[model samples]
Target: MFNPSPKQFKFIKALLFVLALLPAVRLLVFGFTDRLGANPIEFITRSSGDWTLYFLCITLVVTPLRRFTNWNWLIKLRRMIGLFAFFYGSLHFTTFLWFDHFFDIAEMLKDVVKRPFITVGFIAFVMLLPLALTSTNGMIRRLGGKRWQWLHRSVYAVAMLGILHFWWMRAGKHNFEKPILFGTIVAALLLIRVYFAWRNRGDGAAKSRTAVQKRQVTPTLT
Candidate 1:
């Protein structure tokens, strides 16, 4: 019912593509300029992780925004946003392994097991891997619609774990501002989906009742 012209769709895609590259571009510039401030590795790690979560939030918002705006073209950008989220997430993980742990698998595994925040973050990243892998059209087709949908539903859990990771990481400092903001955004997105699903079910029931009423009226007419 909601469709965009070909030209409009192309423009939207191009805009999103440019937006997705901005973070990587900034990272590169900062690296070259040695401008990472105080703790360079920590700066890069936190920046990438923040962008990953932000993009994930935006990706989740696409569906609800599309429904509200009646602009189906927004759906076309969802995959790109999701993949970019994974891209930043990979960078975040790499910064930890390469810069922090110096590729020390044993130490990293030990931390993952011992630290609840890292444990949750590691689990969230693992969950995102499959979603990123199946972002392709061919993979989606191969997985079949229902199965793919089920697998992607893990995003909800990923979001929850991500917020928990952020929350626990900040627990020592008692600073809840950033995590609270992120949590609120995730909650809003989830609530939108819940509301729409319930509304759709009601619509379906009403349609069924209408059909039944038509059948009963037809018998009387006969």
Candidate 2:
């Protein structure tokens, strides 16, 4: 397997950092050029939300890809990719809060309570907040590896919430295409993790049983 040196890994990360920001940059360019269609707010909101899902999908895919390809360096990029997911999620939420609600907290609360899609989206964004805040190495050390991993596992739930949000929102318009596709991708990514975990547990159990059998069969030492 070809392992990336530190410098090569940094270069890859830098390239991905820029590539990930392109969606936000495109939104900016479109806004400046008055190309956000007739409903600028809706366009911005949808675009940001779509990119959030895309990033989430990419973030979730990283682990499976790394394991399958044996490119351990790919794990280093996961934090950045995950943060980008949160970044676009922030943008998506900001559009709804700033443009849709005009910072009216009461109205926003009412909307969230009244609409199931908005409710799930609000919860998903709120869930992402903690994950993003605790993404740093310092935070990981502070939380400890096991605790940090447990907390970060909420990301799977967040992705599910995000899919539900999108699906419910599109239900009103009878648009199932994109929602179904995103749901399938997220579901498959999550199931891949589950499968590996189960297989590893089985492998460990088998090893333990083999060791026990060998010990039982061996003659006792004097």
Candidate 3:
């Protein structure tokens, strides 16, 4: 039901790339026009942070979508979407580092220590670095498939930490609708992954048992 030619896929990918940038581009336009609300820093920071979570959710959905729909092509887009998650995450962290701390490494460290929200966010951002660095084909080949998969599994932890960070940050304001919504989505995606893994294991075990039973019966017949 979902088959696209090479040219069509290329076109679609290009379209997604441009659409992904639209948020940042929109922020730039707002900044240029002095329209980022009264507190521009807060506006930009929140916008970047929101997009980071959004992209993370989108990245996590790729597997479930591909598996359930049988559209393998969705896997091709996961890397790009994951990189965008990192991109926005970097922007979110940079906003705090440059604007909030003014290049003061000491102060940044202090904030990470003194502030729980910053702490979780920093941890999450740090975890994204390795994933982004090793996202290339060459690195994957060097790391081998199993090791690479293990390392990239950090995305799940990063997703949880990110939600916690966002949740804590919003706690003071008593606004939790967004965090709760995204947290539910991430949780559902993770649970779906676990269910599929369990199902595969069960299927494999059943197949092995059946093969063994057939071997025993064949010896008796002979």
Best by TM-score: 3
The models' CA-based lDDT, in order, is 0.84, 0.86, 0.88
| Models, CA RMSD each | 7.8, 8.0, 8.0
Candidate 2 regions off by >4 Å?
Answer: 205-222
Backbone Cα, N, C clashes tallied per candidate: 0, 0, 0
- Supply the global lDDT for candidate 1: 0.84
Reference-based lDDT, residue 65, model 1: 91
Alpha-carbon TM-score of each model against the true structure: 0.89, 0.91, 0.91
Which ten contiguous residues of candidate 2 have the minimum total lDDT?
A: 213-222
* Backbone clashes counted, model 3: 0
Mind giving the per-residue lDDT tens digits that candidate 2 earns over 78-162? 8888999999999999999999889999999999999888999999999999999988777777876667777888999999999
User: Model 1: per-residue lDDT, tens digit, 83-161?
Assistant: 8989998999999889989999999999999999999999999999999998887777787655777788789889889
In candidate 1, position 208 carries an lDDT of: 55
| Model 3 residue 152 lDDT score | 84
In candidate 3, what are the lDDT values of residues 1-222, reduced to their tens digit?
788899999998999999999999999999999999999999999999999999999999987887789776777788899999999999999999999999999989999999899999999999999999988887777876667777888899999999999999999999999999999999999999889767665787888566445423321110
Query: Which ranges of candidate 3 are over 4 A from the true structure?
Result: 205-222
TM-score of 2: 0.91
Quote the positional error of residue 8 for candidate 3 in Å.
Answer: 0.7
Model 1 spans > 4 angstroms off: 1-3, 205-222
Q: lDDT winner between 1 and 2, please give it.
A: 2
Instruction: Put the candidates in lDDT order, highest first.
Output: 3, 2, 1
